[model samples]
Structure formats: structure tokens, C-alpha cells
Target chain A: MMEERKTKDFPRSDSASGSSDQVVRTIGLSKSFGEVRAVADLDLSIPRGCVYGLIGPNGSGKTSTIRILNGLIRANAGRAWLLGEEVPVHVNICRIGYMPQEMAIYAELTVLENLELFAGMYSLNKESLAQRADALLDMIDLTERSDSLVSTLSGGMKHRVSLACALVHDPELVFLDEPTVGVDPELRMGFWDHFSDLKRAGKTIVLTTHYMDEAVRCDRVGMMRLGRMIAEDTPRGLMESTGETHLEDVFLHKAREGSA
Target chain B: MNLVRAYAIALKTLRSLKHDRRTAGFLVLMPLFMIAIFGYTFGGDIKDVDVVVVDLDAGSANGSVAALIREDLAGRDVLRIGTSEDRDEGMNAVKDGEAWAAIIFAPEFTVRVEEAIEASRTGSSAAPATVEVHIDASNPNIAQAVVAELQTAVQAVLVGYYGANPAITVSEDRIYGEDAEFIDFFAPGVMGLAAMMITFMLSIISFVRERSTGTLDRLLATPATEGEIVGGYALAFGLVALVQSAVILAAAMLLFQVSIAGNALLVLLTIFLLGIGSQGLGFLLSSIAKNEFQAVQFTPLILFPSILLAGVFWPLEAVPDLLRPVSDFIPLTYAVDACRSVMIRGWDAGEIWPQLVVLAGFAAGTLLLSAYSLKKRG
Candidate 1:
């Protein structure tokens, strides 16, 4: 469905949104909590059919930026756009998917029940819900344990269930916060393969993670520190510009340069 | 505002309870246990109160005034009358807490009553008879019961002598509750209170869980609006309040034999309104809390005032003059009033519309406030 829209020559969006190709865009986006600034004047853009990785330490503003764009919280002093509409737009929120850092699924419900719940919120009728849920469950490899209560599942399995729930609606733009935090190496590879599949299908993914090694797999990596994007480019460009062979060394060099 | 969205949220909440046996048990049985405790403490007749009677009547043996009154007391089920020759011994029994009260007849009590009756007939002054009652008022309930029993006996004995006292006669014509008990008064109040506590506590805690667990943020990112979420919670908790009411009413009627004079469904309707309003209030207050621990703190803040001032534990009349105005503002006061009017006084909805209107106002107002609070920005 998303591939069809990408192939079609749609008209340019309003001037505020640069073009229909930028699935996610932000300008001077800032947010604060009391005296601490979470996201300070951060400018970012993620194009269609691209896997974007937002790499930052614990106190950096990766999650805050995603929250503002998702309309979960409004930006303090900036504007954003998602899917060619000015953000915090109530009407167009269904086209985006969000998987928060916390285990947000209901612990008392079954794995299948969690996916169906998010599907219902998007107003998917019964027939579509069953079809979408079955496919998602198969992808997540929880088809057999769909009826088991989530509270009884293993930690890695629970994370997989959260991901399945996020993708049940097949959102055109997806935001995943630390999506592979607790997964085993084998499952992580399986998840990366799924993301590659989604990108080929013309879906945009914006994910935040501290795993420096994973940034190599993303099409573009945004190096963030103190609510500011220090460096953003293709992995090879970042490695070459910073004279660092490893992606982890590239981040350390950029972070130290920004601090100095 | 959308029915499908609202119903969907309600279904998810109810479905979560199906596997959680402990929480479900707390939801249904907590109110039942509380009602049992309150009913046991407040309802019932004071039975088998020991009383000593010292009769010193020096006139008429068979048709004596003292014997008539004593026989009247002994026949009733409330008291067990024991004979005593010395008034001091009877007084000592009451003082020692062995007996609830002492009934003493003064010497020549029958002669004095008869003389008093003649004096009244002839329009002359005559000495009054003294039927002295010495009671231990330690337990006020037992004391009141003993006094009421004695008054009935004395009145029955005196009725023949004076023939109903034509000039000072005032008959009580009850328009309602010809056979009301203390349980009858308490059942409706308990139902309202149980409903309020359950609905109020559940919504606050449940909402806080949603926020702390990050589920609320996930939902907010979707197509679901804050109003739809709040409406869904109201639907679910409102249904819970209804089920709690049914269980309470059934228990009250089956165990305590509390009969409803008017419609039972109207009584449930009143509690439902009150419960929905409380649920909204809970949701509104939940904004200040950061977690379930803080959310639990609000229960006492809301429960104590409603229980004390809402006429659940006692009537509004018993409330202090200063606090009566405060009582007027509590939604539970109107609920208890409406429930009592329906269960005991046989009042229909038309007669209790004012209370219903007040409750409905609470429901609408608090729900609006909750939805507004949920939306930091529209």
C-alpha cells in the first residue's frame, strides 16, 4: 500500500512541508521539562523508503524528537510535519506508528489481543483485523503463542510482541525507541531483515538506539548530544569524515569534538 | 464521542479483568465485605436487655396499674423483666452493668394514678404518680431501646385510666414506613457508598497505570483522542458500578430482608449516576499523580468527605449546622437521599427528580472536566 503511494507522482505538499518525499521533518524543534531542555532546536529530516537511526546517549534528545513528531507531546518552540501534514495533526495520526521505550503492552492480555487492540483504535474492521493480525503474528514468530498471556512471556518474546503491535496497522511512518534492546542476536538479525523488507515496501522507519554497531545497518545515522544533532550522514561518510574506522569510534570522536 | 471507539476501550478494560482473579475479586467482594461490616454495626433490634422491676404498689391486687405495666413490659421481645423487692438492689444491678435498666414503681402508685385520673375528670389538682426509671446510658443504643420499651408499656397501661386524653391526644399517621427497621435506612446508603468507592478508586488507579506504563502515550500517538479514552473508562467503570449495586441490593434484601417500597431499578439508576460522577472525579484527580502509589493516596481524600458528609453513615439532619451547607454540595448526599426516598418512602423518579438532576449534573460536569484535563492540548 505504501509502495503504491511512493510510485505515484503526487502533488507537492504545502510550503511548510518541503516535499512529499520527506516522510518525517522537523525544524528548530525544542522541548523542556522544568529547567532541563530535552530537545533543543533540533533540525532533522527522514526521507521515504529510508531506514534512519538516531544514535545518542541516555540524556540525549532522540526520544523527545520522536515524541514531538508523533504528536504525543507538542514541541516547545518549533514545528514539525509527518506524512506532508503539520504535526500534532489529529486527523493524520493513524498513518504513523510508535513503539515506546517502555513495555507498553497490557500485561494481562494475550499477544494476539494486544495487536487487535491497536488495530481497533485505527478503526480496522473485523475481517481486516484478523488478516493483519495473523500476518504480523507470523512475522514476529508468535503465531503459536498468540493466545498466551503477555505477562507469562519471556522478556525477549514480550519485546517482539510490542513490535508486532506497532506494525499491525502497517503505518507509513514508524518510530521505534530501542526496538532491539532485549532481543537475542538471532532475533535481532531477524528484526533487521524485517526492517529491510519494510524499507523495500516504501515504509519509513525512525529508530533511536545506543547500539553503535547497529548504526552501520541504517541508511543514515544522526549523531546527537545534549539535544543537538552533532553529525548526520551515511555511515561511510561519517567514518571517513571523522577518520574513525569503527562506527562506535566515530560517535566518540564527534561527541568529544562537540564537547570541546 | 464515537460509539465504536468508546465501546472498544470499554471492552479492552473489561477483558483485562477476565484473567486477573485477584483484582476482579477485589472489585466485586470489597464492597460486599464493607457492607457486611457496616450493616452488622448499625442494623438490628436491641434484644434480651436485662431489666429489674421493683414493684411497691400498695393498692389493687389483680387490676393494679403496676402489674399491668410490668406485664406489658415482660410480654414484649425486647426486654426480660425480673422481679425485685428492694429498689436499691435494682438500682445497684443497673449501676453494676448487670442490667440495662431498673423500673421502680413508687408506693401507692395505683392510688395516685387513679386519684390523678379523678382529679382530671373533676377539674381539680391531684398528686402525680411516679414510675421512676433508672438507666445506664453507657451504651446509648441499649439505653434508647430500654427507654422506648418502657414508654410503650406505660402508655398502654395509662390508656385505660384516662381513655386516650381527649384534649391532648395527637395520633401519629405515618405516610411512609409503617414497618421500617434500621437496616432499611442503611441499605441504600451502603449501596451508594460502595458504588462510589469502587468506581472512584478503580478509575484513578487504572488511569495512573496507563500513564506510568507508557500505554497512554502509545494510545495518544494513535487515532484515539483523549475524550474517547475518558469516555471509554466511564463506560467500563459505570458498568462496574451497576454490577456492584446489584450484588449489594441482592445481599441486603436476602440477608437483612430489606424491602424496597418503590422501584429497585431507580435505586440502581441513582447509584449509577453517582458512581459515574465519582469515576470522572477520579480521572480528573489522576493528573496530579505520577504513579499508582500516588493515585492510591486520592482514595482517602475523596472517600472520607463523602462518607462523613454525604449522609452515608448518618442522616444530614445529624450533621452540624456549619457542615450542612457542605453536605449539600456532596453528590453522595443526593444519592443517599434519592435511594432512601425510593426504598423506604416509596418515592418515584418524578418525586426524586431534584436529586437525580443534581447527580446528573455531577456526572456531566466531572466528565467534561476529566476530558479537558486529559487533553493538555487539543
Candidate 2:
């Protein structure tokens, strides 16, 4: 089934030219903290301009893998690449946007100021930063609260502001870690729509979520368990191959088979 | 390494402070309040100790020694004199805490003094005429002041009665602080302490919050380098420390009339270096603390040692010989010493270059270590 899906969608060229089609590629990527292996002997090939979801339960190492890819943390062994450049290097950071699972925006700063800070770190020009901030504020539907302090905003509003900050730099590749965990249902739908829009604009997104329903929205999903990927396939392909109608059932079948 | 990115971090810090009114208030007002409390309340000379006297000596043909002692003590404002008819009453006054000391004169006080004088003139050793002083020794400063004042009174009476003794004479010529009061010596120390404490605390808590809240990870994920983040915080906190020092110095000068004998610019420069050092220290400490609560636990670790050993309250000479060397390792010691030498002794860069060098070394070392720690990934 995996071979059939790969041939149907990816169709490898049997040559080095295949790497250009992928934005992120990892080989035997592993990390350990004390006795716990957060990620172990993992390999991934995520195509460019696709919405990829890493689905897992809590403590399943999704965030650790993303952190290793973003160079926030070092892998214990093996190598990962972003934009064809080895990571844990600084050259490709400017080309990526990262939103951590925690509410990472500065609460003491106003919304506009937070956006401005991230923009400045990316070294965006004044005119371009101003336009980018305005457009992101509109997209996040936070244009009115732009002048309000982040500490004064409600939890949902702060989550949206955090998303706006990640997008402010307009990077080609973005990593959003549970971006819709606490978001309201309406805003969660709005966020998925925005993700689709981002993908249509030729940008790659790598997100981590535990919501099975949300996994179906991704172009491809990697189900993780016990620090290893149990399965990777399209939403329809996973459901059809497992003889299950729901993504959660497919994940359960994959997890059981992985343990067996 | 990029100055523009470092400046962006600094600008963001300033913007955050503008919105965090509570911390901003603490940053500016805490130093001012410290200056006021130290300068006004704890900065006075010990004076006007209460003492009681009982005179039992009868008048003699030569002179009354009790009357001479009384006259000498009355001339000096160091003591407030009260009288009692019985020696027991005077001693009771000291024991009851009503008076710091009690002076009791013997019945043959005048005759004994005259006889001693006669024997001294004949080049013979004589029994000394003594004044019995019962003192409360609980407070060492008050006890010493009482003893010194009484000795001065005795010397004055002997000089008047026996003429000036040519055997030995002592003169005082001070190199610094000739007429300076305690507050003048204290203001500079407070400036250094305030700069160190405020800058260190602000940076520690700020960085800890950034780390625990995951903003540090987000920033790290950006193009900003570790050095840029550390440099940015150092620049911002350095400015805040300078402002705090200036406010404290201005308040000290205008309110307490504390003197600044040297170039005011040098004093500020010393404080600025101290601020940078403290900021670097804050960053280094932040790497150890996992949360704001843990960060705050470090306050006493910094406060007690600095206050006791940094010559903030007392000079290094007053600290025990064994503990004195500990002050040399604390960064605040050099800052306080440099500021005092600059503001009180009017010392220039040439005179204080060693202190400035140590402070610069501390700032550079801590900042480099802090930046390296930030770059380390777990």
C-alpha cells in the first residue's frame, strides 16, 4: 500500500533530482534526553508546497522532531536538511517561520510591537514590514487589537496574535506547533482555510496536532507512536488501506500494528 | 555580531518596559526609595548619649577635680549630663538604659590628683587618680563614644592643671574625607548597589520569563544569534541601570546634599560598567533558573553577600580580616570602590584604572559565557 501510494503521488525519478522536489529531508534522525528517546532513527521526506501534519498523542515526540528540524535543539545523531541546507546552521533560519506550542509572544508588548520585533529579527525593510504586519493582522482578524497589549487579550486572541507573528516574516517554510489547540471552532476553521491558502501560494507547512479531524485536512499525515513514525500516507490513502472510515481508527490500527 | 539585530532586541526590551508599568516603577522608584531610607535614617553620626554624674569630692586648696571634669564634659555636645547625689543612683541610671554611662568621683579626688601631679614633677611614679565610669556596653558604638568622650575630658583637665605636657603630641591630617559625613561616604556605595541589584534582577526575571514562556525558543528559531540576544539585553539593561544611578545620585545631591567631588561623568561611567556587568550576570543566572520563581530565589544569594562584604554599610577595614578577601571577588566591590574614589576622593581615570579594568573584565567574561550558554541546545 505504501509503495502504491508513493508511486501514485510522488513518482520518484530514481535520481538525485528527487531531492529538489522535497523541502525537508531527514535520515536516521534521533534524539535522546537522559533515558527517554524523544526521536529515534527516523526518516522523513516532506514534499514542497504541501500541508504535512505530524499526528500523535502527548509525549509522542512530535514537538521534539520539529525542534530538531528548526535547529532549536540538536539531534543526538543523524542529519536533517531544510531548503537543501544542513540544519543546526543559521543560514536557513531566515527562510523559515516557527510558532512554538507555548504562547511565545511577548505579553508585555502590544500586538503591533510583537509583530514588529519578529519582522525586525528577519531584517525586513521598513515599508515591507509595515505592509506585512497590516496584512497579517487582517488575516488573523486582529486588526482592531493591534494596539492592545498581548497580556490584555483573551487566550484565543493571544493564540491568533502568535500565529500572526509567525507569518509576519513571510518565510517560504513554516512550522506551526499545535497552532489551533485553544482556538475557538470558528477560528480553527479560519486557520485551516488560511493553511490551505498558504499552501496554494507555494509555501510549505509542517504542523503537529493530536486532533484526528485536523489530520484529514493535510495533504499528507505521519502518524507517530513511541518516538517513531508508524505510518505516512494521504488522508484517503490511510483510511482506504486500513479499511477504516475515520483517521482515528486508521491511527489506532497503525499503532497496534506498530506495537505488534 | 550584527549590530542591527542587537539593536532590535534592545528596542524590543525598551518597548516591553514601556508596557510593563509595574516593573518599570520598580526599576526607577526602588533605587530612589533606597537612597532616601539609607541617606535620611541610617546615615547620621552617633551623638548626644545620656550620662549621669555623682560628685562626692570636697573642695581642696588646689582645685576641685570633679568640678573640672564636669566643666570639660559640659563644653562638648557629645554627652547630655544628669546629676545624682548617690553613686548607686548614677550606676543604676546606666544599668536601666536611661543613660549610656555613669561617672562617680571619689571623696579624695582633688587631693589625689594634686598629689599625683606633685609626684610627677619630682620624676617619680605615682598612683593614678581615677574616675569610675560605669557604662552600658550592649551597643558597641555608644559604649566606645562614651569612653572616648570621657578620655578627651580628662586630657583637657590635665592640660589645664599641669600645663601642656611636651612628652608626646599627635596631629591629624586626613588624605580624604577630612570633614566628610557618613552620608557622603554612603551615597556612592548606594549608587553601585542600586545599579547592580536593579539591573541584575530585571535581566534575570526577564530572561527567565522568556525561557519558560517559550519566547526564547521562538526568538532562537529566527535569524537572531545568541550573541545578538545577549548583547541586546545588555544594552537595554545598561541604559536602565544608568538612568537609575542618575536618579539616585540626583536625589542624593538635591535632598541630602551629598557631595560629588570628582567629575560627575566618571561616576556615571563607573555605574554604567557596573550595570553591564550585572546584566551579564543576570543572563548567566537565567540559564540556571527554569522559571520566574527560581529566578527570584537568587535575590538573597546576591543581596546578603554584597551588603555585608562589599563595603556598602562599612569600610573593608571594618570587615573581619578573614572575610575581607571575599569582598575582592564580588563585582560590586570594585564598583563601590571606584564610585567612592571618584565621587568622594575626586579620583580620575588614571587613579581608578585598575577598578575599571576588573569591572570591564567581569562584564566581558559574563557576557561571553551567557552568550555561549544561550547557544547551547538540550
Candidate 3:
């Protein structure tokens, strides 16, 4: 079954392929913690240079899917690919950046130090790292607080630091889990602007959030419920198809249909 | 493994510690504090015990037994002799805790001692001269010191009286650790214990924090392998342990005058290896703990057993025979043995290779296990 999925997913590596534009592809990707299936038989494909928001409530297997894609955890069944390379493989790890929902930045370290540490992990040279760190700090509007320890930062500032650390290596693919959960509306607008800039610069972004407003900004959104994708469409398309005015109503409509 | 990546992890960890002033203070000052507490208070020798003596023996025509005891014990400073009017008074002193022990010499002590010596020559049994020792026994060390001092003084007097007869005299020879004291034996073990404890505790708490705070998940997503992560931690903690050991050894030497007879570098190397092994053990143990509070629960589990079985405060020979084999399995045991051999016996690498090899094996095995544990993510 694994071989079948592998061959079906990748046929002739050098040839122009159906998945050529897709940065992330997964089929029948399943994961379980104890008896509860956090993610079950998830089939997802994310195209390059597109912002794909995984919209779901809490406990909807969004974090699990991201973790599996980033090789932090393994799928119980099926396989995944990142940047045309098989995930759970070490070769393309440097090409991918992940920002976890929790505050993953080292609390004891300053914001600049956290950025430098992540940049160094990717073997970035001193000149490039310093330049990139400054740009990222400015982008996050945290240039003044870069020298302060992350623990002293407010929750939203620390979230910005985590996002900056994820992007410090300038990876082609970035996975952000709930990047704007506690962010202020103004900062969330800034994050969306920065993400749009990243998308325009040809970086593929996959993010998970429950906010309908954030979901509306994505090029496409996958609405997840109970370890499965109930619907996948553009924000306007989803509202239109469900005959609803808002993404929240559309999500409720799809969830009712799924349970039915 | 990528050396640069591993070094990056090490640098990040060190940077984090730089900001964590409390942990940094613990790392630098804890060893000094431990040395001061253990070296000056808990590890000092029992000395200058007071003993009340009611020497009722008047004389034996040649000398007085009480005078001889006073002469031997008074000058040596091992025992402080206090005179009592009678056995009741001497016993009262011991009972009142004024003295550690009371030596009540029989009135016929000298006569009976001489008679016993003469009777031994004639191959006949005689009544033995008795010295009844009434001890407080509250502090066993002081009580034991009193008894040991009395025996030594008595033996010296009898041996002098007999003029070193070949038939019943014991000769002395010098070997390793000539005139070694308790502090000398204790210092090296303290070094090993300090290194093991600090390295283990820091790695465990640090790793647990990494996991709980999601830094480990972020790191795992990077290009860094689990081996590189563990290696990075081991390197940083090993260096810290080296510094800690140095502080402890210097303090032990300067404050307690603990001697180091062998290559000091070799002793330090053993301690460093123990640190590496302990860090690996910490990593392995951290995998079982979900949070820092659970990690703290592991302290006494690792500490008390190592202290009791690793021969830190005492020799392995002093442990019960049934429990002797258990000591060999503890990593700190090999460290303590190697360190003590180097610092006390002046043993070089050739004589201490087995211990070094075992320690190396322990480090390698635990490090591999730690890496495996880290890689075994759900």
C-alpha cells in the first residue's frame, strides 16, 4: 500500500507532473494518540506561492497534520511530501520552517538570540543572518524589543518572535500553527500583510487558525472537523456554495452536513 | 553529525543559560556551597573527645597505669582527660554528656597486668586486667574515638614494657595513602558526586523544559538530528561540569587541605567523563518525565542510591556484602573509584584503565540511548 501511494504520488521525478506546483502533498495520512485518532486518512495538497489556511476549531487535528508534515511526528499510515521530497526524511528539512502554536521560542533567550539560534541551525553565515534578523525584527515591528528576553515580552510579542524565528532561515515552505490566536487586531492585520508579501515573494505558507476573518484572507482554506477535511474551497467560494454570508456560517453548514 | 549544527545548539543553550541568572548562579556557586557544607561540616574527622578517667590503681611498685594513660593521651590531643573521684563520678560525667566516655581502671590493674604477662610466659591463664569503658554512645564517632584512643595508648604501653618481643609484637609497614585522613578519601568522591549531580539535574530540567515549552519540537523540525541535539547538550554540560569539578577540587584542596597525589588532569578527566555520562542519563530520564515537576521527583531516586552505593562517603568494602554488586552498576561508582585512585593512590592511567574504560562505555551507551529516546517521537 505504501509503495502504491508512493508511485501514484510521484511518477517520473524529472517530468512535468500534476503535483509540480504543489509544495505539500499527503494521501491517507493518519495519526493516533492512544485510542483517539487525532488525524485520520487526511489527503491534502497545497500549491506553491499560495496561503492555505487550515480552518478548524480546537482538537480538529490541525496541529497533528502540521507536525506530521514537518517530520516532528510520523504518520501511522500513508506518506507525505514537502517541496517534492518525501517527508520524515532529513534531506529537505532545511527547506521547511515550522512555527508551533505554543510559544516555541526559548523564554530565557532574548528575541535576537532566539532568531540567531534558529538561523544558525540552518547554517546561515553571520552577514546574512544579521541582515535577515534585522529585516524580520522590523517586519514584526519588534526592532526595539529585540534585545529583551522573550519571557519579558507580552504574549503577542512572543508570538511575533516565534513567527520571526520560523522565517529566519528564509525557507521555501513555512508551516504556522495558530500564529494570530492572541494577537491584537492591528498586529493581526500586519501579520496578514507580511504573509501576503511572503506569498507574493513565491513562498508557500500553510497556517492553522480558527478565525474566520483570517481564513478569508487565505487563497484557499481547508475546513477541518474531527480529523477530516469537511470542505476545501476559497473563502468566497465556500460562503457562496453554502448559501451563507460568513465563513463561520459556512463552516457550521458543512459541519452539520458532515455529522448528518 | 554536523559539527556546526551541534555547536549551534550548544551556543544557543549557553546563551539561554546566560539569561537564566538563577541557573547560572546554581551552576557556579552550588559546587562551592556543597564543598563548604560537606567538607567543613559533614566530612571532618572526629577529634578531641573528652573522656573522664577514674584511675583507682595506686601503683605497681614500678609505675602507675593512670599516669601512663594520662601521659600518652594528654600529649596526642586525641583525647581530653578529666579526672573523677570515683567510678560513680566518671559514669556521671558520661551520663551527663560532659564526656564521650569514662574509663574506670580497676584498683589491681597494674598488678593484674604484670601477673598476666608473667603467667603467659609460664603458659598459665591469669585474671585479665579490666578497664571498664562507660560511653555516652549518643555520638557513635566520639564514643568510638575514645575506645580506639584507649586501646592505642594501652597497646603502646604494653609494647614498650615488653621491649618489642618478636613472639607477641605487631610491626607496621607503609603503602599507599600513608597517614591518609578521612577528608583525603572524601574529597575525590565529592568531586564525582558534584559533577554527576549538577550535570544530571541540569540536563534533566533543561531537556524537560525544552520539551514542555515546545522548543524541542521546533528544534526537531530543523535540520538538527537527535544525536546532534544530545551531543550539543553533552558538550555544554560536560564543560560546565568540568568547571564545577575544578571549583570543588580547588575548594577542597584549599579549605580542607585534601591531598591530590596523582595527575590532577587525569582526575579532572574522569570527572568530565562522569559528567557526560550523567548528562546522557539525564536525557534518557527526561524522556520519561512529562514536565519539570516530574523531573524533580527523580532527584532522590538518583541521589540517595548513588550516595549509599557509589562509595561516595564510604568505601565499597564498608557496604554490605549482599549489596556490593549493586555498586558496580552505578556510573558514579566507577567515577569515584577512578578519581580516588588518581587523587589518593597516585595511580596513572595504566593502573586505572579499567575504570576509565567502564566510564567511557557508560557514557557511550547512555548517550546512544538518549539520542534514541529523543528520536523516538510520537
Query: Per-residue alpha-carbon lDDT of model 1 for B1-378, expressed as tens digits?
Result: 899999999999998777665456657766775575345434534556788888988766435788888888888768878879998898877654467678888778877777777788899877667777777543344556777887787787778555733211112222345566678777888899999999999988888888888898899888988788888888889889999999999999999998888999999899889888989988887887766756776676577667766767555434554556777888999999889878876779888899999999999899889877767741
- Interface RMSD, all candidates in order, equals 2.2, 0.8, 0.9
**Which structure among the candidates has the greatest lDDT?**
2
- How are the candidates ranked when ordered by TM-score, highest leading? 3, 2, 1
Alpha-carbon runs more than 4 Å astray in model 2? A1-19, B1-169
TM-score of 1: 0.74
Residue pairs clashing in model 3 are none
lDDT of 1 by residue, A1-260 (tens): 01112222333447546555887777677888778898887777789889999998988998888877877776777667788787776666788889999989999899989988999899999999999999988888999999999999999889889998889888888999989887788888988998998899899999999988988999999988889999999999999998999889998999889889
TM-score of each prediction? 0.74, 0.74, 0.75
Against the native chain B, what TM-score does each candidate's chain B reach?
A: 0.59, 0.59, 0.59
State the TM-score for model 2: 0.74
| Candidate 2 lDDT, B147-181, residue by residue in tens | 77877887887887766332211222233444466
How far residue B345's Cα lies from its native spot in candidate 1, in Å, is 1.5
DockQ, per model, reads: 0.42, 0.61, 0.59
lDDT of 3 by residue, B308-344 (tens): 7787875553455455677889989999878877876
Q: What is the lDDT of residue A32 in candidate 1?
A: 80
- Name model 1 segments beyond 4 Å from true: A1-19, B1-170
